[model samples]
Target: MPTASSVIEIPVPADQVWQLVGGFNSLPDWLPLITKSEPGEGGRVRHLTTADGGVIVERLQTFDNVARTYSYTIEQSPFPVSAYLATLQVEALTESSAKVTWSGVFTPAAGTEDAAVEALFAGVYNGGLEALRANFPA
Candidate 1:
């Protein structure tokens, strides 16, 4: 399995950021890769496009309000991978700022290139965090 994590400090209050990221349905507004995320425990996330212009779907595994986190597993991926799990966590650093961490682990399918997969994951994770920072600049 390969894992990647990134954090960003946003000037927005923790509640503000949480309000945006806490809801799974808001992903399409901020995430460039995700086309839409339906609101439900077992809802599906539709990808806009794959590296090869294909589509992908992921199943929601957990969305914990108390923990301020959401996770999903790739059920229909265009990539050659399996057991994909991604999560997002939010923590308040101050009244006017907060830290958001996004992380995930996945196993590339047999014969798939690990480096390429890791790079792709890192790019998407970090890019998403950057997008959030831009949306809620500190």
Candidate 2:
């Protein structure tokens, strides 16, 4: 499996960051790439509309509000990967700082190079984290 991960440190309380990101359907609140998120399957599935009019469907695999983390799998997406399992987590670096990490493991889609897919997700994760950090400007 190919894996990619990105972590960002934000000068915001972990709880505060979690309040914005912890929900399975909250991506649109902080991620500019996601224009809207609609909950389905009793809140376990999310149908996301991208800023560019693309659609991605993801399902909540695990959730831990107390831990400020959630893991999800892509049910449908334009990204070139399969078995895409990703986790987003927030941890306290200090009372006023947070360490947020997003990581994923996946199998490259047919005809897709491993390096290409890995770099693709790494870019997505890194870009998404940067956008997230912007919400809590230092």
Candidate 3:
């Protein structure tokens, strides 16, 4: 499995950050690339439309409000990954600071294995984290 991770420090309480993104289908609220998010099948499935007219479908695997963590698996996507699993976790670093880590592991799609980590996982995770950080403003 190829794994990619991205971390960003936010100058806000962990609870506050989690409140913004804790919901399994809340990607549209914070993810810069997500244009809209639609829920399906009792909120377990999410259909996301990106700004660039791309669509992705994902399923919520685990969501722990007390732990401030959530995990999801991609069911359909344009990225070069199969069997992809991603987790978003928020940890307190201080009374007013927190770190958010977004990570995922996947089996690259066929011949795209070589660049999947950089082009898909890292690009999406890091870019999204950076956008979140920008929104919070350290």
Candidate 4:
């Protein structure tokens, strides 16, 4: 399986960041790549629509409100990967600072190279973090 992770620091309290991101269906609130996230399966699943009109469906795997963390798996997506498990977390660096990490592991599609998919997810994670950071200006 290929994996990718990205970490970013935001000049805001962890609780606040968590308040913004802890919701499974809140991606559209902060993630520019995701224009909308519609809930399904009693809110355990999310149907995401990208700004470019791409569709991705994912299911919530686990959630920890106290820990400010959540894990999810992709059920359908345009990305060339399968068995995708991803996590998003926020850690308190200080009373006024937070560190956010996004990571995932997946098997590349039959014809895709590991590095290619890794790079793709890495770019997505990194770019998404940058967009998240933009939400909290230093």
Which candidate leads in lDDT? 4
lDDT of 4 at 6: 99
Query: What is the TM-score ranking, best to worst?
Result: 4, 2, 3, 1
Against the true structure, what is every candidate's RMSD?
2.6, 0.7, 1.2, 0.6
As a TM-score, model 3 comes out at: 0.94
Which 10-residue window of candidate 2 scores lowest in summed lDDT? 129-138
Model 3: lDDT to the true structure: 0.88
Per-residue lDDT over 1-138 for candidate 3, one digit per residue giving the tens place of the 0 to 100 score: 778899989999999999888888788888989989999999989999999999999999998999999899999988877889999999999999999999988888778755645567788899998887776865
Pairs clashing in candidate 4? none
Q: How far off is residue 7 in model 3, in Å?
A: 0.7
User: Once all C-alphas are superposed, what RMSD does model 2 give against the true structure?
Assistant: 0.7
What does candidate 2's lDDT look like per residue over 1-138, in tens digits? 989999999998999999999989999999989999999999999999999999999999999999999999999999988899999999999999999999999999899899999999899899999999999877
Native-to-model Cα distance after best TM-score fit, residue 119 in candidate 1, in Å: 0.9
**What's the distance in Å from true for residue 44, model 4?**
0.3
Displacement of residue 40 (Cα, Å) in model 3 is 1.0
Alpha-carbon runs more than 4 Å astray in model 1: 38-53
Error of 4 at 20 (Å): 0.8
Estimate, for each residue in 1-138, the C-alpha lDDT of model 4 and write its tens digit.
789999999999999999989999999999999999999999999999999999999999999999999999999999999999999999999999999999999999999899999999999999999999888887
